[model samples]
Target: MKILVCIKQVPDMESRFRPNGEKTWYDESDLAFRMNEYDEYAVEQAVQLKEQLGGEPEITVLSIGPERTVEAIKKALAMGGDRAVHIRDDRYYQKDPWQIASMIASYAKGEGFDLIFTGMQSQDRGSAQVGVIVAELLGVSCATTLVGFSYDGGTITVKRELEGGIKGVAKLKLPALVTCQLGLNTPRYPTLPNIMKAKKKEIASLTAAELTGEAELTATAAIYPPAKKGGGLVLEGEIGAQVDRLMGILKEKTAVLR
Candidate 1:
């Protein structure tokens, strides 16, 4: 069996972010980069599937970004991916969902991968379209936001998370795609030996132009943080007084009471 896991390098959420000169995305110069948090669950699920199948599958971790993405790929390798492919794109942040998905689908086409795994969405962009778009472009079945997964070498069964704490079950044959969600599995920390071994693993590099000629379907006019709002009003006194004050404020400030 063959499995392809797609991942991305994103700025650590804790780091301070500033808009770039173009104001299209966050500046990368002073930011610390790490693998997208959601992709870690995808990688863990892939590794667990390999173990469940007696370690016969070839797991290839793929990422599209600038050279800094090599670090994220290495981390996936340490977590049990056999090899990696890096699709280099210096202006990756500028690409819209269509362009990004096109590049991934272009490379994945005819690759004979039995399964493809990706995160439900990226942390930075949070546009949860790439995996499903890749599946559509490849003409395969797809399921998103998977919380549970099982495979029997011929078909895969997954439990998808729906709104309102509901789960929808789905089954897909070979050559399918799935986008993993959080709590699907516990990600393991890479040990020292595995980290060392990952440094020697093979990583094939390619350029975005080499993969696809798709043009951007959307453009960002601007990006900025939300405007600050005033502090909340505190109600002080007994329960009845607090309720009366709340009702008075609502009637005065909003149309809800009317």
Candidate 2:
């Protein structure tokens, strides 16, 4: 089976984020980066599936980002991916979900992949929409937050985690998309030997325009995050007096009443 897993490089969760000069996104100067945590589960799942199937599955990790993303992809390789494709686009920093999905779908459309795996969401954006969008674009079956999976003869069965003590299971044909959830498996650490081998693995790079054959972004702008504010407190008073005082404050501040 040929498995394709989508991965992402995001700011290290430990960093303290602050807004750039603009008020739309965070400044990244002091931040470090790591692979998206959930995508790591997806990678581990693909590797385990290949082992159980008794065939050398060609597992390819795909990412859309800047040069730093190579480090993240290498981490996957160190764990157990056959190769990687890095869509090295500077504009990837500001891409919305639609554009990101479009690029991945465009590249994966005819790759003869038996299964496509992705994380539930990216750590940086947390927009849990890419896998569904990519599945829609490819016109394939999709299962999200899959915790367990097994294959029989030619059909693949998946177990998904859901809310309120509900879990879902389904079977699908060769070509399918699945987004993995946490607790699917404990990801193994990369041994020193595997890390050395991973460094030698080839990481192929492609441009966004090259992949899409046309420039898709309208224009790239400097992104920044919103400002922080101090917390407010409610003062103690009698219930009736508090009600009257709150109404007066609202009226004075908002001009709700003259």
Candidate 2 Cα outliers beyond 4 Å, as residue runs: 213-258
lDDT of 2: 0.85
Per-candidate local distance difference test: 0.94, 0.85
Clashing pairs in 2: 24-224, 25-224, 25-225
What alpha-carbon RMSD in Å does predicted model 1 have with respect to the real structure? Answer: 5.5
Tens digit of lDDT per residue, candidate 2, span 42-134? 999889888887857889999998888898999999989989999998767567777889999999988878889999999888879999999
Best by TM-score: 1
Best by lDDT: 1
> Which lDDT tens digits does candidate 1 get at residues 1-258?
989999999999998888899899998898999999999999999999999989999999999999999999999999999999999999988899999999998898978888999999999899999999999999989999999999985999999999999999988998899999999999999999999999999999999989888888899999888776876987888999999999999999999896
lDDT of 2 at 230: 62
